[model samples]
Target: MSFNHPTTVLVIGGGAAGIMAAITAAREGAAATILEKNERIGRKILATGNGRCNLTNTDLHLKHYHGQNPKFAYTALTEFNYQNTIDFFANLGIMPKTETGGKVFPFSGQASSVLDVLRFEMEQRKIIVICQADINKIKKTDNNFYATCKDGRKFQANRLILAAGGKASPNLGSNGSGFSLAQSLGHHIIEPFPALVRLQLAESFLKQVQGFKFEGTAEIIVDNKAKARATGEILFTANGISGPPILQLSRKAGEYLQKQLKVWLKLSLINHLSTEQLEQILLKRWHNQPSQSLAFSFTGFIHKRIIPAMLKAAGIEDINKKVSNLSSKEIKQIASILQDWRFQVTGTDSWSAAQVTAGGVAVNEVNPQTLESKKVKGLYLAGEILDIDGDCGGYNLQWAWSSGYIAGKNAAFV
Candidate 1:
């Protein structure tokens, strides 16, 4: 298949970055085309933020982003900041509402809403989107880039922007094929790993507390030292623990696990109170209900189902013993266990379960300012295909928008 007009910019991957890049390129008066491997464009976008589509974050600090050189995102983020993202979407008739942690979502609260507006914009700009067009090879010859698809269809363009995402959520479209495509074209790729994923633990009692959730702080302990920590609602799984806080710290834990280092998860059930404070509270409760069974004494304090497991893990052999029989030393032990519950982290879930990839094409090989390849002129890179990965929330999507804008603008001019 061939286009009637010459394609000025050919964008690979029809994800958040690719869509934005194609739109941005077309907006700059360049004929743009997007070749999506999936049957439909924006399949991944539809899954973001539990279908609500967190567009961007108001608090887009440098610290939230991670990579070999996180500063590489400085230029793109500054050029297309959160306000720019809001304005860009506003033009497409999207009103955004900011939630806690500065997570910005569409007023419609539907990921489909974001995709619909983007599709409308693409139609208005006459951008060509060819879904199920999986390119098998990309070659630059005679000042033009030629992309040959698996079906033997060939496409030629003046410039190419690779926005194919990382390996995370293969079902949603990204399968790390972009890395090989970039590597074939003289770019170095960083080893990719699962990020923002659930972790597996070595504890057998996890099955008992499976599905139990509580608001607490989860800390990543590596080599007997605290490496990272986050506070949020944590849910116990049959295999391990999960939730926002665990996801936040998974990157560090995954890295440590990759290196075969000792890794542990320290959970604080009652983050609001110190260990001493918790001990006093337990003592007071025990005194008020001295006749209450040790297991039943914590009925109102925490989930009844988890109390027995907690008591057992705390070395309490007889959970049926009366609170009056509980010694002061045992009370302190319970308090310490509640505040410093440790679990050996075995590993993280597979790439399919991860929200984003931790590594990709190395940033040093690409120009951060214009999102262009340093080795191949007129070749640009964008989105999670690069090494940059942001924290949970809307930060990753924001990176997509920013990098796509920069790459699209430069690809159009080239």
Candidate 2:
């Protein structure tokens, strides 16, 4: 039942990073092999950008990336860059198109197209890919690295690239097992947490406004101070709020919640209007329909489902009361609530619901220039397996391509 296959470079985890690493190594004239735990490679890539597969972003600034040592990503990001990503895919027959927020996708607008091209390139290069390869142990001795699977199968290589992803979206293949693999080789882990996920709030009226969607700004307030903010579409779930803006703030909220600090999400439902402007608008509307019930007053303003919950939260208990009876103070309170609807953040959704992982193998333990592990010679780490996780909108995949190329190029020579 045991077999030993030798290659010049062996890559674990056939996700975005692993696939790129193997391909890059093969292009460097080194025989490369990929070990994937799933039935097929790039399973997670299918879920990116809601299946459009954001390849990379036009905006490649350092501000979008997050990690213990985010600067560690500087070298790889600059070396490969977004232009390199577009060109790389262009050469692979993938026509790149730029969308809003500098997000890039294939011209076909299909994630399957992206995977198809990557698979085609791997096939053309004759790269070996072993699916369902649950590597349980990895060790290096002399100049060769050995990886053993749970089924007693073995693989050997001169250089090993641990491109296995972090602990997010286990169904798509990553289960945080890469942390254990890297730790086995004396690497430090930064304690992975769910990122790009929904935040569960402690508010009791969430179900009342569930399914309500709007364009607004979301801010994460930790210990009474605003930590991070994002403005985009926001969604209300049965137990919490979500959508792009909320997901962007989930990382900081989760981190603060891990410390048991008080976390709150302040949502600016009417972000376009100033507080004074909102108050004046409400007054004008009430003046036009002075006899209208408070509940029906906002019929044309916001979602009807949210009106009751929002009014209750703003301290307006008598929704049946007429608008004429409302004092000036009550109108200002409603305006303030519309501008800043605060909800206590209990925690974030589980990893299965997360789009990416917040932390991973510490980047400092690996050389930024080459992505080679300082603890183990010839051991390269890339992708979500490293601590580098980027903001939504193709940044994470860009990191994958950048680090994978660097790791693969360096490992090929090693």
Candidate 3:
């Protein structure tokens, strides 16, 4: 049972990748249609960058991404990389501003503007966008794909591009629908997990200082070996840790969690000094400020809010205790606490808070150059669905543009 219609291309998913694919296919002389399960296209776009989409990064690098095959993204990424993304948005009349660390934000600081530009491009090109259409299954016959919706509607096309995102951010309509479709078609899926998310800490003191934020370095240890580390401003949550540094390290921590392995998160509140160096410095400080209380002496070296805790950790019960009266071992303990304040990460925040998913449709089943499926003809993979994900600061969005562009261009041909 099928309501077959003549179309050159059918693109599923209406996020950044699907919309881009629709625009490119239409521009390349194909009758393109986009099927979005949600009521609106680009639902996730609104949540990006806290309402202002960090569209892309001025700094693009391979090191920002993760996958079983790290090299799998090279071709498509190179084909429609960062500059291409900037040009595409610029052509739409959106002037992006570069913020700290090369993050690019729209000058208007509105994600809706980015969505409008994309929607306008589609409208100008006469691309059909169908909303609230949940594609139940994709059945391929010879040279055509028949996409049957859950509501009993069916769409037929000579070519199909699956730009459906990963399992993360389900409220945005990315709840692993793409995975179900890909699996039905015999595509290998690299087990999906949350990435670019905040980690849930085992310690409860994080709640007492939930809103507190500070610049620190976080190191990840997997089975006692240093796995990864990041340095940035981190925010304490009621049950966990969130922020740039913690988010970046959370990816590896999630992977380790999936493997049933234990991971340790070490936090360095004072990153510039080693324990021994700090100890020596503190000893010298005692000589320099003999009459100063231990807590008072730490005022210049550490944040005032955390000074009491540091002192307590150093076995200093009396806040007004003179630095000169502190024992040698107590001084060393204080120095150690200053250098390394460790935290244990038991898990991560749910997928809703995650910026991107770690795994998706296996890259091995898709052509790295064209983003076309090696297993299914006329089937293409893009965005977070292709086992390609990047770090925060706009790299993931860059992947969306690059993969979407390639899939759209190729799906339009033949």
Query: TM-score for every candidate vs. truth?
Result: 0.96, 0.97, 0.92
User: Clashes in each model (backbone N, CA, C under 3 Å)?
Assistant: 0, 0, 0
Off by over 4 Å in 3: 1-7, 274-277, 284-301, 308-322
Q: TM-score winner among the candidates?
A: 2
How far off is residue 362 in model 1, in Å?
A: 0.5
lDDT of each: 0.92, 0.91, 0.86
Clashing pairs in 1: none
Order the numbered candidates by TM-score, best leading. 2, 1, 3
What is the lDDT, from 0 to 100, of the residue 76 in candidate 2? 96
| Residue 145 accuracy (lDDT) in model 1 | 97
lDDT of 3 by residue, 307-358 (tens): 7766775567897889889887787777776666666778888888777899
- Candidate 1 regions with alpha-carbon error over 4 angstroms: 1-7
In terms of lDDT, the best-performing candidate is 1
* lDDT-superior candidate, 1 or 2: 1
Cα misplacement distance, residue 231 of candidate 3 (Å)? 1.4
182-244 in candidate 1: lDDT tens per residue?
A: 999999988888999999999878888899999999999987899999999999998988999
